[model samples]
Target: MTEPMRISIVLVDDHPVVRDGLRGMLESAGDLAVVGEASDGPAAVELVARTDPDVVLMDLRMPGGSGVDAITELTRRRIRGHVLVLTTYDTDRDIMAALEAGATGYLLKDARREELFAGVRATARGESVLSPSVATRVVSRVRADTTELSDREGEVLRLVARGRSNREIARTLFVSEATVKTHLTHVYEKLGVGDRAAAVAVAYERRLLGD
Candidate 1:
């Protein structure tokens, strides 16, 4: 039988006890190895660079160095290891900050050992994993953003869905063609789409354009 590939890891948390517990828990799985550890963000960055582990388990609120900043710096330096945030705080601010800073995954400290192990393995493969609550918050935020189109933008999208050209839309809404183009641009941004066809599809998919 072929031996399983060992997934190397670096643990980055300020607390010695937390690191020790994590190391023991992860190493208990035959394919996971704790290759190095750091007590702060700066140290974590250095350790990550030195060890070149497959995954870096990061903590957000260390006294000396912030995990978000460490992830940002790692991104800036183009480090090879994927960062998986393992922190106590799952607030919108904390979760968004770490993800925006290039964390590959986010798992709360209360996660089960199996979940933690799975999160590490997923991160090693460059997959995005989020705790259930965190995922809910992120999805809600995205939905809220996409649903915030202005009344005028909504009118523009509805018309576009009906096969109206920009000129036709401006004429129907008593606006200039330039204004129609501008509204479409804003609609594209809000819907996170590239152009008119994509915007219309996303709008209907989200039920923004009702019958």
Candidate 2:
């Protein structure tokens, strides 16, 4: 028989009941093990260092520090675990900050049991899983910013939107491939999209490029 993938997890929340409930749910999954629990951000960091879980289900608002702070600290220390934020806050600022701070995934507190379990596993596997509502919010914000691109940047973005490769775009624009890459990077930041496909979609949705 193939061995099940073991996921070591750490739970961090201010409420005991919440922590207990999550622990029970995680433990019931044969491959998941709750290695440690923390009631606050500071404790969470200490336990994470000592236990070295593969994934951390971190609560955003905690007593000693915010989940964002914990994520920042952990990343600075070069910890290998992925931080999957499990919080009630769905504000754009909170979501963006957490993502920018290196959180691998985000799930709201009201997520179903299956989603919670799936999210933990996904994070352990280095995949991003955003709650549906959170995903919509993020997509909306990116779409809203698509108009901020410069003309040359927009040209690069339009070609990118049409599934053109960087080399192809460079050839079409009579520019160096390195210059095309530079424009692509600027386009990504301005549009708030992570990659070429996402940037292209955002440009089309926002009418930043002519169809």
Candidate 3:
């Protein structure tokens, strides 16, 4: 039987030792190959263009530019390589930004060698693999519990949760009733609810309205 083709990868991180360690770890898997290494975003983009690897192990906060920017640029340039974020950051902003910029997967640096290897292979296969912590953040953010809701919408939802009528909410917020209705419409749409009570319930459940 023919041997399976190796998955080529490019390592992008500012720290030389981290890169070396990762290269060693990945190469230990018989079907994996580290084809090139870059210490920053610009170099990473260039190296990726040259090597055309199956996957890119990207660090989020690097010099020259961030991994988010690199991923966006690569997407804009239409590079075929999938990017997998391997970094210490698991914040809502960092996770959302990397994913929004087209990263195929997000894994924390604390992942075991086997997990890292599996993540890279999954990423190369167009599968998304998020670390457990990262997955939680993503799920929470998707529930509309985050800053994704505009301030005005949030304020409207808060008043609604307090059992305030549209007119009462408008009076409390100092906005016109028409404006309050518009804001509530937006809130309901964002929260994926059909009415005021449902929107208020979702907001509270998602902790969008602080306890």
Q: Whose TM-score is greatest here?
A: 3
lDDT of each: 0.92, 0.90, 0.90
Could you tell me which 10 consecutive residues in candidate 1 have the lowest summed lDDT? Answer: 140-149
Task: Answer with 2 or 3, whichever has the higher TM-score.
Answer: 3
* TM-score, per-candidate, Cα-based: 0.71, 0.69, 0.72
Worst 10 residues of 2 by lDDT: 140-149
Per-residue lDDT of model 1, residues 9-119, tens digit only: 999999999999999999998889999999999999999989999999999999989999999999999988799999989888899899999999999999999999899
lDDT of 3 by residue, 1-211 (tens): 9999999999999999999999999999999999999999989999999999999999999867789989999988988879999999999999999999999999999999889999999999989999999998899688655436888888888888888999999899898999999998888778768998888777777788897
Clash pairs (backbone) in predicted model 3: none
As for lDDT, the candidate ahead, 1 or 3, is 1
Judge candidate 3 at residue 136 and give its lDDT. Answer: 85
Candidate 1 total steric clashes: 0
**Which candidate ranks first by lDDT, i.e. highest?**
1
Candidate 2 per-residue lDDT, tens place, 1-211, comes to 9898689999999999999999998899888999999988788889999999999999998877888998888888889889999999999989999998989999999999889999999999899999999999989877665448889998988888777898999999999999999998988878777898888887777788875
